[model samples]
Target chain A: MYICLMYSKEIVKGTLKPIVLKLLKEHGRMYGYEITQNVKALTEGKIQITEGALYPLLHKLQAEGVLQTESEKMGKRVRKYYKLSQSGEAVADDLISEMLDFMQTLKSVLNPDYGQA
Target chain B: MYICLMYSKEIVKGTLKPIVLKLLKEHGRMYGYEITQNVKALTEGKIQITEGALYPLLHKLQAEGVLQTESEKMGKRVRKYYKLSQSGEAVADDLISEMLDFMQTLKSVLNPDYGQA
Candidate 1:
């Protein structure tokens, strides 16, 4: 559960939920370990989600009905895979769109030449 | 201090500090009201910073030695303009760079195709 990167932890924390939702949207369904590995691979080891951080959020999302899980037997331990629920699909699209729009606004704030008066 | 937009309050809250720092970096120095007006105009009113949120952060940054303030009199009222201090300039650059990098990473997370395997 180590985050070895140039970015600060707080900033990464804010986007975790959205990142997970986006990954699930693209991948269909993913187990906890698969999620961690994919994030590492996707960011090229720049951003690593710790089990300490990931599991609680996954459980919380499941509790909130935003995520639905299915369990399968692997060896002896059960592997829980997560995907978005019906309502969660709508929530994910809305959140992703809002995040994209917010990013555009942030770009405008950073580069005032495009920001107009 | 109304944030009447599609974006959630929590999402906007996370970026306020960086947004303020980027503005001070771009505009040189700005007063509280001016900062709010610029953000409103820049985002085309999609994002607005409330006095309640802005003042506390300004004070906190000032206390942390990341910002220095100048007071100018406008008739009966004194307006305080904030700019980065000597050390603050460094901090501002660092924060701005980190924010931009984080945005790129967020984009990668949102779009898996560009994220590479």
Candidate 2:
């Protein structure tokens, strides 16, 4: 119960782009379904992200100039792939660092007694 | 140069609320502007989140029923305090666990060689 009311997928959805963009920035490019599959494989099913959440974040990231998308013919449906823009690459690095710091700060606040210096 | 394009504040802005909500879920009621100041203080300016980004996120969180708000008189202006709803509390816990797992998966893929067992 203590942990039950602590986080939201909507918030996760909002932030997933930096995670995806950062990965793509290093790997060059990746596809929609592929991105979802990769995340699932990496987390081993503990952190399953639905297509509904991912696609919208991808679209929004692409629209925000932080991500670039290209299309490829894949059987019947066209597969859309995404990569980071020059600006996006810069942003991803900053994001990872900031998030790391943010996590620490949260840990300290949430466990202040033991978290003390 | 390589790190220049790894993160985007806009993307960060979108996800700030889940973190904020998680904090609020633990802290109970907190103010609008106070939220921004606290995040800044916590991150040591490395994660200086602006009021523009925070207020919108807070408003949206409130709208989504992940947050509840009440107004209080403060000098010349009224300050709004936000807390988690029954549903919002449940969401925060899930978000934190999911995000933690995500961070680990991301670390592995980004650093594949050392990441392997």
Best-fitting candidate, scored by lDDT: 1
Candidate 2 C-alpha lDDT tens digits along B1-117: 123222345534544655686569767989877777776666455456677778878888788998898998889988889998999888776665555544445455555554444
lDDT of model 2, residue A63: 85
Clashes by residue pair, model 1: none
List, for all models, the DockQ compared with the true complex: 0.41, 0.21
Number of backbone collisions per candidate:
0, 19
Runs in model 1 lying further than 4 Å from the true structure: A1-4, A113-117, B1-4, B113-117
- Cand. 1 TM to true fold: 0.87
- Candidate 2 chain B — worst ten consecutive residues by lDDT sum? B1-10
Q: Candidate 1 on B1-117: residue-level lDDT in tens?
A: 223354677567578888899889888999999999999987878888999999999999999999999999999999999999989988887776777677777776786465333
Which 10 consecutive positions of candidate 1 chain B have the poorest summed lDDT?
B1-10
lDDT (Cα) of model 1: 0.82
Task: Give model 1's DockQ, 2 decimals.
Answer: 0.41
